[model samples]
Target: MKHLFSLLTILFLLSCASKAQNSSKEKKTYKVEKTNAEWKELLSPMAYYVLREAGTERPFTSDLNKNYKKGIYVCAACKTPLYKSEHKYDSGSGWPSFDRAVKGNVELDVDYKIGYARTELKCNTCGGHLGHSFDDGPKTTGKRHCINGVALEFIPKEK
Candidate 1:
């Protein structure tokens, strides 16, 4: 009976130790935890409105849309790399347009808001609302991914 008790106690202690070790070794993922007021302070009014509240910036207003430089575009929310410079093109819609997306990066949804049918693009990692895509583009794929400059941060490639 004493030997049986000792074996059970040893097993219980081992189980607890294993659990503690596992928890300690587990990787911790970091998420941005900012209050609305804090976020407003951290970002510009336009960026905060569009990225956090899903507001749309006026068309033909973003300077980045007119940009034709080579660089990688990243998500403004989490800084995750999203689109490539090669994907960019001039669609004359006032927003930065792309023919395709970075592989396995963004989430696309069919948006029917305000009696208009469009494809809404969003950041897959941070869920930041980007903008709508259209079928008018200068590409063989015929996809014009109209993106909001507020939702993206451009990093010009090294010359």
Candidate 2:
């Protein structure tokens, strides 16, 4: 009976491991799908780097950081509206900071690229890398979405 119990435990462990592996192998699908070549051609060099390759732009380099006009910020790659001007605020992070994104427009994922777990935010529509979200933010939302400016385009609110 003891030997049988041990064998059953081992089999259960193996089964659990197998399920974990399968889940990891599953890839996330996005609404706006595009070929790599198409993305490269459609976005500017820096935009492509940030959105497609998950690269970061230099701090304080994006004009959108200081933009205060009423507008909607859209994904530069797919034209999906991500954030509103009303949510934009200066977090002194030298990047465009927003307290929240448009509902259901941004998705969060875990990333360990920087040697620690970070809340990585992506455009839900295109799966484009937008930026990392942090907990240090104003009391309103307590979410600091530190986005790459190149990953977004501002559409000024029309009168």
Q: What is the C-alpha RMSD of each candidate to the true structure, in Å?
A: 9.5, 2.4
TM-score of each: 0.72, 0.89
Q: How much lDDT does candidate 1 score? A: 0.82
Q: How would you encode candidate 2's per-residue C-alpha lDDT over 4-119 as one tens digit per residue?
A: 99999999999999999888856789999999999998999999999988889999999999999999999999999999999999999989999999999999988888899999
Residue pairs with clashing backbones, model 1: none
The local distance difference test score of model 2 is: 0.94
lDDT of each: 0.82, 0.94
Worst 10 residues of 1 by lDDT: 25-34
Which residue runs does candidate 1 get wrong by more than 4 Å? 1-38
For model 2, the stretches where C-alpha displacement exceeds 4 angstroms are 1-17
lDDT for 152 (candidate 2): 93
**Highest TM-score among the candidates is held by which one?**
2
Q: Relative to the unseen true structure, what is the C-alpha lDDT of residue 40 in candidate 2, on a scale of 0 to 100?
A: 90
